[model samples]
Target: MTILLVEDEDRLAAALIELFHAEKYLADHALRRAGKKTPVLMLTARDEIRDKIEGLDQGADDYMTKPFVPEELLARVRALSRRQGEVLLDELRFGDLCLSLATNELNAKGQSVRLAYKEAELLKLLIANKGVILSKETILRKLWGDESDAVENNVEAYVSFLRKKLGFLQSSVRIQAIRRQGYLLLEEEAL
Candidate 1:
């Protein structure tokens, strides 16, 4: 027998990784608590109301008992997937850069850089909306949630971080800041 531990910093990957891989009755409380909010579906043999209640309170977005029908399982997953407006792909690309959704690593020109979780999310947002202006309000709402205390400075800092990484990679892609507007992703030649 072998054991594995999944500790991805990305919330979605971290929450779901163990569920698909591990089937034991054991629940990794620490794993569930690893990152920020994620859509988690807890699967276990325990069918008790108390168990289900505890699971839900412990951060599970959904719960399933043992011997679940495969179709129902798929449907539940689909529902959770829709909860997050953005469907995470294996990778996202713009110009010469590739952002790995699973590992939060950005690659360009044969070189790679690991980004902090927030940095990755910001970069993903920018890539998904390449050439479109994304206001600070929009970025804050989407990435940090409306209720978060993150201010414009937070957004500015992350943007600066991404810019430095892009420079280090020597990628043609660059993030352009619109005065009193927002930020846009554009290749250097597009200037």
Candidate 2:
């Protein structure tokens, strides 16, 4: 998979780009001028909570703090690639809700709405494992990678976004938070 490595440190960027190349993964040091379908792995020395949050908020697929292990970095990249490949189906369905991976749209009843990258990824996860409770940690790892500084609240925020989109489409499917358990996608009548 192609990785956009946004690192300002010259030495670190060169090392990472070399490592990714050695592992047979394409990597670039600069950010693309336009949005890309390829996953991004942001490498930065900024480790403050707000910095990490801002990186994620601005659409970095995953974030890695400086002083990281090369092994862990490779693993995170593989995880992102795996998740990218897992959704081979063009569309996922639950009740009346339809999530289109190709178009990045969520449709329900007679309405359809485009989804942001992360939103579509989160919804795809829930729908792929419908009726299963995915813990906040699991969601965080699947969507943001383990190396990311994202917390449970990040998952909650995305869940809230998907919930609003579902509501906007008048969907019968609901993303139900299971308190101590996590979240499960269920039909409204099942709740």
Best by lDDT: 2
Could you estimate the TM-score for every candidate?
A: 0.57, 0.55
Tens-place lDDT digits, model 2, residues 1-191: 56778877755676676687456455566674566677888988899999999988787889999789989998998899887884324566789987765778888888999998789778866875688999998787666654678999999999999999988998888898898999999998887
Model 1 bad stretches (over 4 Å): 1-88
* True-structure lDDT of candidate 1: 0.70
User: C-alpha displacement of 34 in model 1, angstroms?
Assistant: 39
Clashing pairs in 1: none
Give per-residue CA lDDT, model 1, range 46-128, as digits (tens): 89999899988877778888667766865776676677564535677889999876787899999999999789878867875
